[model samples]
Target: MSSNSPSSPLRVLVVIASSRPGRLAPAVAEWFVETTRRETERERMVVDVVDLGALALPFLDELEHPSTGVYAHEHTRAWSRRVADADAFVVVTPEYNYGMPAVLKNALDYLYEEWAWKPVAFVSYGNTSAGTRSVQMTKQVVTTLRMMPIGATVALRIGDSIEDGRVSERPMLGRAARQVVVELARVARALRPLHLAPATDGTTPGPVDGLSLSRVGEGDDVSELLVLQRSCWVEEAHANDTLDLAPLHETLADVQAWAKTWTVWAVRRHGRLVGAVRARAVGSTWEIGRLMVAPDQAGNGIGSWLLAVAEQHAPEEATTVALFTGKRSRRNIALYERAGFHLTAAPTTPDDAVLLTKSVAATTLA
Candidate 1:
């Protein structure tokens, strides 16, 4: 899985929804990706092909509900990661018995949250109805998963669009395929806030309207966190007039290694990683570190919100939360001070850094 910065390329996964041997689905998908390749590059987006045949996911077998995001099998976990990492989807489906194929249906049934709040477009091919009946049948299922299906679509009749079991070189059809990518990109960008907002199961709402707060996952979020951490600390290095900042210099491996010892929370708005913080219990004190918010997203109380969240995660035996920042980072120091953090006069503190500590009462809850 690839991580996305706000300025990085958007990920659009094109799903070939057929699994039979010698199927036309691959050829159709190839045409669509080639047709849209130039446009996707120009728009700062990436197109990935996911053939259901290659995936070979079994029928839904997990005993737990998909909404829990608890997969009992390795295949389900891999599938969940792939779907969760994508910003949008384009399903290349074919009609079967006047409806969607069983493989596509089974694939959709295997996960829940991975499909939510993203845009999906359909490129369907079949003998009659241009495989539109299959698209119609799948639309209701997508809606139940909180997915928004776009209006632009590509429907091809086998007799008219296929030649020698391949999609023919029709200019109009190629243009329509490109248009599907354009529309999907626009709708996916527009609908990103829905994808980023925190889940509704008593999750805390962020200070910003569309901001989401959640624990970071291992594979998909690690790289994004590394990018965000570096992007955010560039401002700190400038403010402090020093190139010795730790966050600005940490590698991907360092971030991954730290996650094992820390409970990390990521913040997103409109499907873009904007802020993050990590904390862990060090004996009786909850040690918080690496609090960051994007330079453009600052002054919105995200840092304070994340700090409160980290403090809330402290163990019952914890009596104080502690952190350190650049000595010249006055804005950050003020924010921490307002959150009841006071300068700590520790003898071992770095010469260029200021240490801050906040007392945690037993009844304190975030």
Candidate 2:
């Protein structure tokens, strides 16, 4: 996504889990801001630091268990809301004698479903082990919470690196922080569907009536279809550094011709078009293309649902499915991967297009 997209920003919540005076949380947060500013030019994301020390959240104590849906305490409910609203998280922590601090653990323990399907990266500092213990322990907790823990981590050994309560030699820390931010951004975008679904009794609800799938045709609904295409192309143009409406308008004739030979579906929700997919039988393969969704309607499992429907409609003689996306569309690439497509080749154009394909049984039923 382009940094300048005029949508609601991707919210990054940096949680400072230390309450100690003169601690390294501020320096760590600064490092994060600096690194992220340089690495991500996309203005679509906004990072906010949540200082747990300043919040003075009390140790967990309640009349009921956290998993029981009885969060009576005001702080617990407020914190849970904050955690739920965030798209991604970074925990800045200090190692306390080979374990994460009790305060941090308690903070995490106060919520259950709020943390699921999100992405988390860590910034740690310590004297001996450099908070490696805290990182490991925190990973275990985050895994149980079902959040994706990214590969990048920042660890600072503060023995000689701290001068007058300020971090010295920040270049290394900056690099590490940048890596964490980039990976977190990637994973966060990948997990958007999982994160955006409404929390139920621990299960995602089946398709609702307004969100049902329907085939697209000349006589079929076209209003929502046009909106979805417009939104998707707008975002694509912004991210791929191309002229808006050029590829889309140019592809109209191709799209119409292809639609004649393909089964196209317009995904609708509440009587509005949210997404579209076209699957055409090419040789022995079912070529899926023009998979687009409204920017506001993305991250809500609509794309996956449309893909599933398209797969079910593939011709019985089809052997595989294939599609292409721009190299800059990292989110689309990851989604296609999750849906069982594998990268087939590098980009042949200057725009660096990525080709992906998925194998299917030739005799499979539609």
lDDT of 2 by residue, 123-217 (tens): 88898888889989999998887778899998888885667676675777778877887888888776765544222111232223356456777
Task: Indicate the TM-score of model 2.
Answer: 0.53
Backbone clash tally (model 2) = 2
lDDT of each: 0.79, 0.69
What does the lDDT come to for candidate 2?
Answer: 0.69
Which candidate wins on lDDT?
1
Candidate 1, superposed: residue stretches over 4 Å from native:
1-4, 197-366
Pairs of residues clashing in candidate 1: none
Clashing pairs in 2: 3-42, 3-43
Error of 1 at 114 (Å): 0.9
lDDT of 1 by residue, 1-366 (tens): 223223446788899999988789999999888888898888778777898998999888988677645456768777876786688999999999889999999999997766877899999999869999999999999999878999989999999999998888899998898898889888877765444323231344554667767787566589989989888888889989988888888888899889887889988887888989998888988899999988788755567567766776778788988999888886677556545567899998999999999788521521
- Alpha-carbon runs more than 4 Å astray in model 2: 1-8, 40-43, 197-366
